[model samples]
Target: MTRSLKKGPFVDYHLLKKVRSSDVLNKRIIKTWSRRSMIIPEMIGFTFAVHNGKNFIPVFVTENMVGHKLGEFSPTRVFKGHSGDKNSKNLKGSKNVVRKK
Candidate 1:
């Protein structure tokens, strides 16, 4: 479920303060751990260093990214491949097989 329309978008007060005080954009990266906080128009053009559990990843907020969560830009999990041996005979279909001469 999304946030109630009556409450309005949830932007961290501290973050808003930091952003409001700064006038430069793309010059400094704002380091923050508020991944759950929603992105606002004031964040546009600013680059943020959002923490992804282990380290901080740079995230540049644009007009298109407004109303989205900070965490969406900084992914936490790494996608590996599916399990199983490539040479296993149990593999489906023998499309690449050739008959012995």
Candidate 2:
């Protein structure tokens, strides 16, 4: 039976049940899969590439991995500038903003 669960975002119980029933998920015992799964990797990958470069710079793609506007709230280095004054301000006139240890 489908049981409605109020996870952070709207998650359907049937879907959760199906995922839990799956061998892979059950084996791993994933209690509450976060929405960051797809995004975190991309951000890390971008960070890695930047770190490797002579001048590590954040480059926020205009669109996210899904090809839609990456929300200003979304953690990314690349700024679309179009995201508005705030986003543009967040990524002002410098490409090589150094990171602190």
lDDT of 1 by residue, 1-101 (tens): 88898999987898989899997643788999999889988889899999999999999888999999999999999989788787775545666666678
Scored by lDDT, the top model is 1
Flag regions of model 1 displaced more than 4 Å. 89-101
Clash count list over all predictions:
0, 2
Candidate lDDT scores, in order, read: 0.89, 0.34
TM-score, per-candidate, Cα-based: 0.83, 0.19
Q: Candidate 1 has what TM-score?
A: 0.83
lDDT of 2: 0.34
- Model 1 gets an lDDT of 0.89
What are the per-residue Cα lDDT tens digits for candidate 2 across 1-101? 32244433333354345444555322332322222222222232222112212333333322244322223223435566654465555665677677688
Clashes counted in candidate 2 amount to 2
In TM-score terms, which candidate is top?
1
The segments of candidate 2 whose C-alpha lies over 4 angstroms from its true place after superposition are 1-7, 25-101
